[model samples]
Target: MKPILLDVPLQLETDRLFLRAPLQAGDGDVVYEAIRDSINELKQWLSLFQTIPTVEETEIILRNAHIDFLKRESFRYLIFHKDTNEFIGTASLHAINWKVSKCEIGYWINTQFSGKGYMTEAVRELINLGFQQLRFRRIGIRCESTNLSSRSIAEKLGFKLEGTLRNDDLSADGSKLTDICIYSIIM
Candidate 1:
């Protein structure tokens, strides 16, 4: 079979944010520190976040991400503050099931930036990328039910709440089980 050409060199800009490919060498550290410093504030909502990774590990991770990007198997973007040029978060279109023409959106923002509508704006741009450029048939988001902000963003963006997976996932702190709210936008 021929290789799938799924790369898109798209840099999206919102009023206060810049969404671009996660290509820098230390981009993971940029993301790790942003979330590490606010672990307490974010643990409740961001489940994939673990303890702060050392700079070395983050560098390796970032390098690997870039390699994966070239292979067209995954696409991850670092969300940066346009004014400050600071790495603020990460959003990914991964688990791409091409046979179905669908992908899942995963995102996390720094706690300080929460409640500011930044992620919502960023996610909308991601959806546009999926639909317009990637030509995906559907895009989906999954978040913890208790995460009101994520749920609100999904709902506001016209994602239908497909169902709730009871105790489907673990919280970031690993002390509690959380329900996964699956939301999807069908194109």
Candidate 2:
């Protein structure tokens, strides 16, 4: 089946959050603000946040993400609070391989929204979407070994620790080598 022809949901909901594709022109403003507020923490794990981006740049990046969504190359869901409608963070099913029926899950939360289990809740929804809705055979989560919080989410969600890659990649800031932890759930 063609990935572009797949009937993927643009939005998903949890008890406290909603995850949606970045489709609106002005959506970047909120996302940019979240990034700005969480830049320090984000920079530790995400190379994209190494430098704060302007609103215009964020908008452009989101536009490209929309294009990717349309092509079904990837899905980037912007997380929001259900009642307050505040942007929490983003969770993505990327590095997809439709033929193999597998993909990787990636996520980050605004510093303000961290430690509330919001990210873990958002990811649980993604896992359901990937397995039950999308019918993926395997879903994987990869994070730097030093990112204990991220590792905890995977562990808490019952994703088995497959292995750890020694000196797998450079840190987000490219300052030094870092180990990569691989976790997965197989359907």
For all candidates, the clash counts are 0, 0
- Cα-based RMSD of candidate 1: 2.1
Let me know the TM-score candidate 1 reaches against the reference structure.
Answer: 0.89
Q: Mind giving the per-residue lDDT tens digits that candidate 1 earns over 1-187?
A: 3226655765788889999886765676677688677777676765444566677776777677677767767777888899989777778787788778899888878878888888888899889888998888999999888888788989988999999999998886788888999999989
What are the candidates' C-alpha RMSDs?
2.1, 0.7
- Which candidate leads in lDDT? 2
Q: What clash count does candidate 2 reach?
A: 0
Off by over 4 Å in 2: none
Return the clash pairs for model 1, or none. Answer: none
Q: Candidate 1: count the clashes.
A: 0
lDDT of 2 by residue, 24-72 (tens): 8899899999999999999999999999999999999999999999998
